[model samples]
Target chain A: MAQHSLEVIVENSPGVLARVAGLFSRRAYNIERLSVGPTSNPETSKMEIVVNLEGHALEQVIAQLDKLINVISIKEIVPNAAKAIVHDTQPDYQN
Target chain B: MSQMNGASSLVASLEAAGVDVMFGIPGGAILPAYDPIFSSSIRHILVRHEQGAGHAATGYAQVTGRVGVCIATSGPGATNLVTPLADAAMDSVPVVAITGQVPSVAIGTDAFQEADIRGITMPFAKHNYLVTDPADIPRAIAEAFHIASTGRPGPVLVDIAKDALQKLTEFNYPNSVSLKGYQPKLSADAQSILDAAALIAASSKPVFYVGGGVIKANASRELLELAQLLGAPVVTTLMARGAFPDSHPLHLGMPGMHGTVAAVTALQKADLLITLGARFDDRVTGKLSSFAVNAKVIHADVDPAEIGKNRFVDVPVLGDLKFTIAALIPALKVALAKNRPDLTPWLRQMNSLKAAYPLGYDTPKDGSLSPQYVIERLGKISGPDTIFASGVGQHQMWASQFISYENPRTWLNSGGLGTMGYAVPAAMGAKVGAPDTTVWAIDGDGCFQMTNQELTTCALNNIPIKVAIINNESLGMVRQWQTLFYEGRYSNTSLESKRIPNFPMLAEAMGCVGLSCDRPEDVDATIEKAMSINNQPVVVDFRVNRDAMVWPMVAAGTSNDEIMIARETAPDWDSQEL
Candidate 1:
């Protein structure tokens, strides 16, 4: 199944990470790549979450994620084709 | 444009990052940074020593779950913070240490009070920076915080030279940190989770290995659900002591070096080992090759590096434990329904093993008080939420055996480090972290006296942590070994003749309430009185039987099966004597 990436912006505070992670965890969705860091704005931080799921599963993940109060924005970041190719070239490192 | 000194800029950056407190002691080398400390909004806590500063910052950080900030001067001042820094690093506590170095020109010169701070801390710290230029101060502090708070969080040191602190620079704090090689893997492979679930379903005797990562990832609910669905016994690591409720029927206490016999046996007999968020430390795995010999290991951890670091992992699921557990639970539910394996016989055997090796103690019919009685009573009074922190030796083992820590993070001991004088400071930190929760420091006579000076710190901060000192009048754990292995040589282990401080008077001097329980009957009353008083710290000197020893002890350099079931009673002794 194809995996989709969801970029979410949340408030930079304690328990925010727990709440967002808890949401996906409660639904039993598999999160593939989750990278969180501070955004340009001081109050908000960007969380890049790549989840492995089909189209219907991706919609469910987005719908459930949108309900979180701290979530400021959500978008899909396209998987870098070059990085994927490089990873494929180095099959030894594949997890 | 007007330029500010590097120290001022460093202070400004820390203030900008919302750091309200800085813990440290002032010294000659770090005097330049001390000048700017008072001007900044960050409050400076002047500790008795740099070690105390490191511990205090650790306490502050543990409570807030933020990056703990501590400062010190070069050489000895910086060296004093080494123990606490190592403690933080080993336990994965987030800490940022700022040390003032000698002048940039004095590098490698070995001048008076000039030591290689960076070189000394390189092995210990998560990341370290040596800033000779004033321009690097702001960036260094920001990077230090970033590295300290990120994945597999640990202590980060920033050594600022005297010249850099005094030099002028245009200050600009980087709003964000970008490190190329420091990315923490936060997601698991979908196939790995499925494979792990499939393995769990197929195996008849499966065990869920829980650790501190479940608490860190906040995946307890997912873990509990999976364990319940699969009907697997949960064995926790020392660090993950309370991940599962100890009272639960399926929960087989802790496993490894000092683990319960039932837990160790369960791990040995299991066919599938689903390890969650636990690094297979040597303490947990006696012999790596022999550990879980019958089991196909499925290791799941947030840190990818820990996947195959210790044992050969058959299935590796690398991701946030909460996410991984959440996904694996449903898959396991489906797998369990399809493949129904009978584990009743295994569980019955485990139960029988537990019954055979029940943790017991023989209290003197009428003599000096017993530490076992005190700890057992403590387990009863203190709810599951209560946190029990202990120092090294017999008292720590007694606490481990007697206290049923049913919740995660409730029992904080210096397990890997075996650091003495850890209980009092760690309890102070746990109390600060969870003010509403009851925090007890179970210290031995030897370990209690090591850091009893910190009673003043507790009193000053109004941290009402209850301390129960098992006063055996000697180094009990070592004495037990000397008595058993060293043929009763009893060399320097005896503290019987050594003049010790009057604990009650010492507690009073530290401006805290004190109690002494010489009789087993007084244990309950004293502990109750201490718990009731919330205004200040309380110390209860539990004068236990000097000969009392921690039983079910697996002697050093011996296998787990060679456990000593009874203290004072040898293996070949007659059963009728009991």
Candidate 2:
């Protein structure tokens, strides 16, 4: 299984986090990393979730999440793209 | 804005949503809401248990094509609604469940009669809201109904704190809901429709694998038009038993486990499968990898998640089935105009398969009634217009197979979740929803004992639904499996329920007209007697043979190619004689 990251923007209402996270647990997909915070739009929050799953499984997870009524949008962040930017900024940080 | 308490506003919101009926049992947390229900125009059926309320709501929703509402209080009452909520979620029934929660301040303290229902139902509910603020009642309710009824419909829950219900608030029912993330695609893309049409035009062997979405979308007419145009055989899934006319010329019976040989064989042999609204459920697909491997699939569904969730989809048309088929008909006509593939041989083969392996059950050598024969007679006597609700198990399969359905919303059952105690309450709800129509609950003895208390609800409320209990003295389906898999060791499957609580006496005790039948000759007269009683609910206990099992079986997780025509009798799929 490969790690994939998804950035989800959703209505920052009570239990929205549970609703979003519940899909993964219900489907038995293990989450590798997760973070959440209010976005520029006060009404909505942004959640970043990373999971280890195959391509088809990840696609199903995305589709299930997209069905939620409170979820505003979802985007897949390329794992390498973020690493490349960090590398360019500080090449010797990890070393 | 009108001034009122939150509870009143909640009821008012339901009224505004055009909900005329609801089911529930009042409890501490929900008592406040009941006060307003008396003054409101919505008719509320008081059920014996909270589970009954939930399943009744599901039944109401299935038959009416509208959101069914069920109310319950916190703690056990709220938790009791879980099964029905899960059932509704699995079946994609539109249901709005309202549960009372502990006062906001005491929620975490585990106050008396407190339950975190919103938290409990998060996994299954289409959407849920826990309203703590009195001012939020109207908006929350509006959003709840909207979420439950739209897109791929399922159960939605709204839990209100007791204090919130009691607190005085201004009720301003929203004119419209603005959910940024909840727009369901009503129509398919033109290119996708065209692609599907081209596939349909080119394929010599095509089958319309119809599912419940056709009924949910109210697209049966469009489906009929498309099937007539393409001249492909139609196979309705269990969840979609009545989505297409059973008597239609191109219709092959239900497909999957316990499905007709003709329907299952056509699906197995088809070159192109036009799968509509039906998910490729494990029950339907049998062994997933080997299932219809040669068939190219054009899956059209309202939910995109369902398209490739199980099987590979060659063409995915994401939209409401009504709109998808409406768009496809014109495209298919155009495609067919150029190169029309004659489907005569394919249709001929389907007919031959259907004729060779027709759905049948032999009469028991003993005098005991055959369950299949009972169901067949029941269906024939009730006619096609009657609504049939069944509890999950052998009886449910028989009802699906024996009954000839010509209209949508006429068949209701727990297909996905396979909940056992679904029939009684669901039939009650169906009766309420369609008061002019005759509704029958075909339940197994094992299943009947689960939620038969709803007969009281039906009797008291004057929802005169007829109940036909196929009493086989055991969990027939489980026994069938045990007989097949195990060395005939019954192990806990037997429920000597015939002697205990005697169904007829139980029905009479619940204020319903009770009748019992042990012989096949008395089945019709008993049904007629039960049917003639329109003043109150009627229960007919049919003591059928315990050894009888649902045949044409694709034993769990096995391939449809290995379907058993009878016990140890596999169909000869390799033969070219047909």
* DockQ scores of all models, one per candidate: 0.02, 0.26
lDDT (10s digit) by residue, model 2, range B160-195: 999999999998999999889999999899999999
For model 1 chain B, the run of ten residues with the poorest summed lDDT: B569-578
Q: Write the per-residue lDDT of candidate 2 for residues A1-95, one digit (tens) a residue.
A: 45888999999887888887788889887889999998889999999999875456777889999998889899988776332211011011110
User: Could you tell me the lDDT of residue B27 within candidate 2?
Assistant: 88
Question: Which pairs in model 2 have colliding backbones?
Answer: none
Scored by TM against the true chain B, the candidates give 0.92, 0.99
Q: B483 in model 2: Cα distance from truth in Å?
A: 0.3
Residue B47 displacement (Å), model 1: 2.0
Return the top candidate by DockQ: 2
Candidate 1: stretches off by over 4 Å = A1-95, B1-3, B39-41, B62-64, B497-499, B567-578
Q: What are the candidates' C-alpha RMSDs?
A: 11.6, 5.4
TM, every model = 0.81, 0.97
Q: Give model 2's docking category.
A: acceptable
- Quote the positional error of residue B339 for candidate 1 in Å: 2.3
